[model samples]
Target: MTQGSARTDLRIGQLNVAEGPAFEEFYEIFCEALPASERKPRELIVALATRSDYYLLIGEIGGRVMSFAILYLSDRYPIALLEYLGTSAAARGKGLGAEMFRAAIDRIGSDSLVIEVDSDRQDSGDLEMRRRRKQFYARLGARQIPGVEYRMPKIGADSPPELDLMVRPGGGRTHVTKDEMAAWIEDIFRGAYHRAVPREELARMIQAMPSHVDLIP
Candidate 1:
């Protein structure tokens, strides 16, 4: 279907366990789109699905699923981590990804949303792809968390994984101080990543961020 028609016929909602076909499609497509090192095991996906904080949303057009988004919402705060978002290759470049994102941000009221992007690394040759990915989010009004050296925990044996934390204002203006950044880091580590960030590492990460900074746009 065309982009305009897809938007007109679009339907977005949580991907519950009962939606077997949709969920399977999402998983299969996600596996194809993401690298093995970056992808999570199917069991983990199932486990996270049972939790209230984790959300898996499926976007469908005329009853056929086309995209998926995985979000982790903080129970104590109005913040969310956009874990993964993907559209089937056949349906890409037709605004499905952006449409699903807009719906998600609107649904969550975008108080504070965090997403990770690959950092520029000399050895990693996908620098341009990473930059374009950042630019895509920038177009969506998300900005990099300035002055922070964020290191994503190694997932699937990839050592020294690095990522840039990007934030965006959803409902209102935002002021991200060091303490707030710390809180975000803590929550993401424990809640989303399912691992505790070491105190020293956390301290270093927080220290890299300025004592106070505003990333709202």
Candidate 2:
């Protein structure tokens, strides 16, 4: 997809291979935009691009890569996880992030897209930055899924970071049922995390979910 305006002309699409200049450019921005704790090893990320269910979307302008998004499509569920998204420092403040997000959703064509954001409830990092990130998604129609504490799967030896799970419902939906949310979570734990998360831990998290999860602003 392509979006053109006075300030930017962005062309976004999926990158199937993990090599070449575009992939290299995407990786450069990925490493720079996301902290070590929040990202997986370079090899593992590259491997995911080879999978049928995973998509690596890249956005560029005038043939220069400037942004990317990693989307995980669950085979057993009608949901996709927005695993990682980043815009190069040089491309910041040009509304590329939001455009990339919408392009990802459009490419996946899923009824729901789940994203993980740093939690304000915990001192994960810069609180103000976290607030701004949440607000950014909010403006794009994503809302927090309250009553549950969400965490990213552990990267290497580091413990998982607490994050807020927000969902953007498509097809004119307003909420997700408990069962649907539970399945999506389990799919994420198994498909996306490759069952790296312990079964007992997964059970505990699901057990704490509310019956009806309303996306709240």
Candidate 3:
């Protein structure tokens, strides 16, 4: 297991097997950090566990949730897409979140990282915090890809909703030609976005691509 030095006063350990009733202890951390959530930590963890491709890890201090991140792998894109991420309200300024992230990077080992931030953050103050997340990825030399749409039908998305794509390239796949890129995007959009994309729109978007543009899928 990878370990990073953290504040001595803080317990700074990883969360393990928190899907059961044991999560009650960590409930306050979620309630305090994410008021928008309807249930406690354990309840959410149980629901999240049922989803395929999702992974969860956390940081705790004195039995409180100090930091946590959720990752879900795409069917076609090997990228690990970070979903829910939060640091305790009390532990915001500490290196707890960074430590958790570093541990994730170590576990994934040079695999690409991808995540979406609500473009508007209109629902919560997390938008600003999400910017910090972007900075975090940048600090690790992750590349952010703009102008990409994130449509997830598995999440019951109905439109070709657009979100910026942040990518940490690790596999060294060469950039692909425009046509190839379009095909690649189509495949992932189908897999990742599912029914959210209308078939006609998918074809139109891929077919209209300029020949010279290239992107790595």
Candidate 4:
């Protein structure tokens, strides 16, 4: 909360993969905290079950999953997408969110801590929360992708619509061309979408994203 001191923890990274069932259950439970429309696709679950990139980072005050985070690795950049992050309903705003984010970002130091926030060209309640969230990340020295727009389409489809692709290149500039940035997102969907976000589907969505001028660049 004060600084990027605890951006991540290797404790969960050290977790054994045999807990796939538990991981899946936790994955579902974690979904409740995310915006209903922003849930991770099913393909991501399969990838998480089959691969080890997804971190079931559990935050505990006294040995409980007060909060959890899913960190998705990237193929094109030396970064980890902050993917799905949330605290338990009973645990919001108690510094648990900050600590969880810090612990994760700390491990993947210097690389971007990218996240897609809902876009708002018009200020509203959502925009206010976005402002607050941005402030939180700013405290950790992360940068938002300037001129960039983030979006996620409807489930089982590729051409729903665009939302907001907010980015935070941690403590530095993480430059990428439009083609490169779009591919970066496609990489995310293909690797860890909740359902089977096929390569083609991911490609379609990525192709639809708008270009931007990144601050870190």
lDDT of 2 by residue, 1-33 (tens): 345533456888777563488888998999999
What candidate 1 gets wrong by more than 4 Å, as runs, is 1-6, 121-123
Q: Can you rank all candidates by lDDT, best first?
A: 2, 1, 4, 3
Candidate 1 worst ten-residue window by lDDT: 1-10
Query: Model 4, 61: alpha-carbon shift in Å?
Result: 2.0
Q: Write one digit per residue (lDDT tens) for candidate 1, span 31-107.
A: 87777666777988888879988878778886778887888888766689888888888898888888877766865
Q: Please rank every candidate by TM-score, starting with the best.
A: 1, 2, 4, 3
- Number of the predicted model whose TM-score against the real structure is largest: 1
lDDT of 4 by residue, 1-217 (tens): 1122243331233223466554554555577776656665655554564565666566544334466667777656766787766777776777777777777776677767677555555566678876677677667556555545455546543443334555666555655566767666666666655444455655555564446555453
Give the deviation of candidate 3 from the true structure as CA RMSD: 5.5
Superposition error at 211 for model 4 (Å): 7.6
In candidate 3, what are the lDDT values of residues 1-217, reduced to their tens digit? Answer: 1244456544433345544432544445555654342222355566665566656666656545567766666656555666556677767877776776665666566556665544432355567755776787677655554434443333312342334455555566444345444454555555433434576655554454345432343
Q: Give every collision pair in model 3.
A: 153-193
TM-score of 4: 0.68
| Better candidate number, 3 or 4, judged by TM-score | 4
Off by over 4 Å in 4: 1-29, 41-49, 123-125, 156-162, 170-174, 194-217
Task: RMSD for all candidates, in order, please.
Answer: 3.0, 2.5, 5.5, 5.6
